[model samples]
Target: MCAVAAVLLASGASAQSGWGGGAFFNADVFRADREAWHEERLVVQRRFSAGAASLEGGTVSRNGFTDPFVATDLYARAGTRGYGNLRAQWAPEASGVPRLDLLAEAYAVVGTGWEASLGARHIVTASSAATLGTGSVAKYVGNWTVRARGVATLDETIAVSTSLSARYLFDGVGGLTAPFAEVTVGRGREPVVAAGGLEIRPSWVVNGRVQREVRSGFGVSASLGYIWDDSLTRWTGGLGVTGRF
Candidate 1:
């Protein structure tokens, strides 16, 4: 993966300065039965600008799951004078399960110290899957910053749930862009059914994550997660390395 990222960086730096790609591997170790699985991901991103409009596309592939999947996302943003910026994204998945997601967002810079955003998402999935709704708001404090984001899921098969995330960016700390920590908690139902027509109860889960920026285009992250259910009292740990051109 490192080799591929290096090659892409070199090529992009020498050419039209628009194409770049990278690869990643994520391994999770289950604390209950000592089961471990690894997932590999590949990402490619491109950006273009015309007048006051900009377009970007990122594609990702996830392997090592029971069923591998590919996802592609395209985003377009048009800049305005003072009010805000308009952004839209189209994300489609090809996992033999057929899913499409559309997201639209509007962000406005207020005064010189505050920004607010409102967004909506619509998802369609095969087999009557759950639908997701998301919203976010952010504010800048001094030069260093903090932001909060939230997401919700609603459907019959799964109970409603909400998650909140917070982040802070440390400025000039060893020339890092942002070093942050986040915590998320939510509740949802499990999709387990028995032949006797029994349904599993809902459960609450909590997770904490921490990440640091190592250099200009390289970083490392680790996360620990836990579930409160008796049968699902599993702790998971992960480590990841990322680089960009």
Candidate 2:
């Protein structure tokens, strides 16, 4: 939950990868974790025709929590008929062993507009326990694209959740302007979360969302968005930058 930004790495036939900077704000999450609840990150990522990998690290800070912590995460995705991803995070410790978490998932396209995935999340702590998770996603792409996803974990750590999203891309703008929105519901203790945002491309990059352009080679892009959940009445916004080189 440190960063769910660009959660879906590849969709359809195209892939997106580059170097970027990002920030995430978890409202009242400070109360839950007690330390390093808010994070700022610098990331380097690469996405090939059939696979993707990324490395990110930064400072996780929160008040009255554990000390300001330095954390790094590694993510990988690959496959053909289906795809798989591995995500790992580590919070370095000065004295003892590092605090770490790992998650891995495999997904495959089932039909014309459907993909199913199964995953597990592990907390490598003293007890070293793991949570089994499963999810399915469906997507339709054309003039307007739409997607829906549902996920649930065996353990309560990651509650059962579902989300529906849609977006319109401006063909006239070189597919640069995209307006999108998503609604998410959490089954257990977590509240429903929603977000509405726009992606605008200036130069060769998009400043609001993640989508590969019609034509690709190299470009610079930026993204900004606001999120709202039942738990936080106030809107929380985030910013990100990506450049291909």
Candidate 3:
């Protein structure tokens, strides 16, 4: 994806102002079989007065091969109290990764403390394709934010999941520190792997994450998660760093 990165940087340089970007890396290791998956991404974005555009290139390593992907995201204000986001991704020669993915969402701000969003996602692989619909509602109270999300498959085999999360943000010395916990339930498809192949048959999941901005334009985050089902159970932990310029 080196050529993709060069193109993204060239486009970012053309932005008149409010240009910034970041890099991120994450890895997940399954406890049961000791298999690991790694992902790394570089992003560049330009923020306009009312909208933003970003391009990201990333690689996913799993099994014994790596797949490179490129994604573009666009965010814009819909009206005084609403916004929309659209994202698309392409990974041509990928088996574990989706060859084509598209997502679109619209968010509405309700009064002062509530927000709601509706979205849909379509993913295509070499063997199969699926479309999913999602909706979420979030409430902000004091320094705490609570959100509930639901997802359902739109294809023939019906699967659904619901998740609830709460996050607390603290104004620390450098910038902001946030910690969050989430719980999801129901028989649904999750983006996880088993036996070197992507599997989507998980019953429930629990996740916790903490992020801290240690200095100006630099941040660190760590996460722990557990996935459970009838035949599989595994724990995953990951650490990430991000820098903005």
Best TM-score among the predictions, by candidate number: 3
- Please list the residue runs of candidate 1 whose C-alpha ends up more than 4 Å from where it truly belongs after superposition: 1-22, 27-38, 47-65, 80-106, 109-116, 120-126, 143-148, 154-159, 171-205, 210-216
Q: Write the per-residue lDDT of candidate 1 for residues 1-245, one digit (tens) a residue.
A: 11112110110011112444444555444456644544555556553331122233333222221334444434333343122223333333333222454555555555454555556554544333334455545455533334455544444543444445443434312111124555667665533222212244566667775556697766676767776655545555555554445
In model 2, the runs with Cα more than 4 Å from the true position are 2-13, 17-37, 66-79, 94-98, 124-130, 143-145, 156-159, 167-234
Count of steric clashes across candidates, in order: 0, 3, 0
Candidate 3 lDDT over 52-128, as tens digits, reads 77788889886676889999887776766767778888988877678888888788877677888899988777677
lDDT of 2 by residue, 1-245 (tens): 44333334334423334443333333223123333234466655554444555566665443333323344344345555566767776764411222565677777777775666777665543333335465656564643445554545455355555555554433311111112333332222221211111111111111134433233332333334333433232323344433444
**What would you estimate as the lDDT of candidate 1?**
0.42
The RMSD (Cα, Å) of candidate 1 is 8.6
RMSD of each: 8.6, 9.7, 6.8
lDDT of every predicted structure (CA atoms): 0.42, 0.42, 0.63
**Which 10-residue window of candidate 1 scores lowest in summed lDDT?**
6-15
Clashing residue pairs in candidate 2 are 34-65, 207-222, 207-223
Residue 26, candidate 1: alpha-carbon lDDT: 51
TM-score of each: 0.56, 0.59, 0.79
Q: If candidate 2 were superposed on the true structure by all CA atoms, what would the RMSD be?
A: 9.7
lDDT of 3 at 182: 30
Considering every candidate listed, which one attains the maximal lDDT?
3
Candidate 1 clashes between residue pairs 3 or more apart in a chain or in different chains = none
